[model samples]
Target: MVDVTELEQRCADAWPALVDEPLGGWRLRAAGGFTGRANSALTLGDPGLPVPQALDRVKLFAAAHGIAPCAHVVVGAPVEAAVADARWRVDVDHPGGAESLVMTGTLRGFATPKDRAAAVAGTPSPGWWELAAQANPTTAQRRVLGSGSRVGFGEVEREGVVVGAVRGAVVGEVLHVARLAVRPEARRGGVARSLMGALATWGLEHGARVCALQVAEHNSPAVTLYRALGCAEHHRYRYWVPGA
Candidate 1:
């Protein structure tokens, strides 16, 4: 079984929560209403203040940014209980607001098919950002996807146009994957699989033995894809918002 505590810390390090302020130990993040992972406060360790005070600070910060106050709490963390006791309900309305699984796997077994022509780049290309995001990416979104010590942007091109795009970040022995997307016309053509294979190869080259990614519980297709690629659930986390 993957160690939940260690996995949590690894994830925080690999895909850092870009925050506006460090409230004691918590990360106060706001990313222009992007994914919940970037927009919510990540309550990892103790906040060095009373739970109420910490919560108050989070609320004020979010309010000032014209966004809802949300906290990303690991399932078994102490802050999860505290937030629940304070009547902060788990967010379920937003697309990625509910529980998400952290999946991890070894990269050695990933084999890129000879027929697929996937390439790994040091930075995301303009076509990659367009296809993966389906629109112009916000500055915060770009940072969330691209900012890391060792980041790889993988893409599969078809007829000279980028069709599939994915990102991988190597931190310690873990390679964190995110932003996997296939163009509408390129779906179901093994593009996603090719992209993953390329990323796994890149990860292995960068001294990463383990690969990890976060997927929403309701995304059955993506979950199935990752599972087929040897990923298993390491832990779960949810976004908690103040009040119902």
Candidate 2:
């Protein structure tokens, strides 16, 4: 069986929580409002301080960023109980925040789509960012997507414009996929599959053995697409926000 804990750590490393401050063994991350993975405190292990004290520090750190205090807790982790004891409630209503499923698949036999071609760049191009982010992306969001040690920005052009985009970051043996998006009018056109295929091919060329991604449990369409690609759930996590 794959070591879920190690996989979690790999995911964290692959899509780094930028501007992280360590409080004991916990990571207090803040990256504007990009994503919860970069904006919430990560309870990875023993915090080296009392649970309550660590929680207090998290609150202060989030307050300093002018964001609500939040913790990204792996499901069934010991820290989950501690946070619940302190009155933290899971954000059930937050889109994609209630439960995120980490999925993984082998890249050994992956092949690029024959009919679709993608332009791969070491840094995100203007078209890639515009398509992937939908709106104008903030500097922090760009850094989160493109600043990894080994990153690939894949864009599918249609009619002289980017219609699909995805990001792949290699960390050791894992290729973490993120920021996959396609234009609304381009959905159901295999744009997403082409992007994934291109990224997987790029990852294999760069020595990656496995591909991984996080998707919200509520995103049935995305879940079905990834499952069809042979990815299986490796783990799950949820965001725990302090009760108002």
For each candidate in turn, the TM-score is 0.91, 0.93
Residues 100-180 of candidate 2: C-alpha lDDT, one tens digit per residue: 999999875454854557766798878887877745777787678768789999999988989999999888888889888
Error in Å for residue 226 of model 2:
0.6
**What's the TM for model 1?**
0.91
Which portions of model 2 miss their true places by more than 4 Å?
113-115
What local lDDT score does residue 181 receive in model 2, on the 0 to 100 scale?
Answer: 88
Candidate 1 residue pairs in clash (backbone atoms < 3 Å): none
Q: Cα miss at 42, model 1 (Å)?
A: 1.2
Worst 10 residues of 1 by lDDT: 11-20
Q: Candidate 1, residues 1-244: lDDT per residue as tens digits?
A: 4476666666666665456577887878887776787778888778889877898889998988767898888898778888888888888886874999999998977756445678899988888988767468777777777688899999988788998999888988888898898888989988898889988988888998999898999999999999999999888999888895
lDDT against the true structure, each candidate = 0.83, 0.83
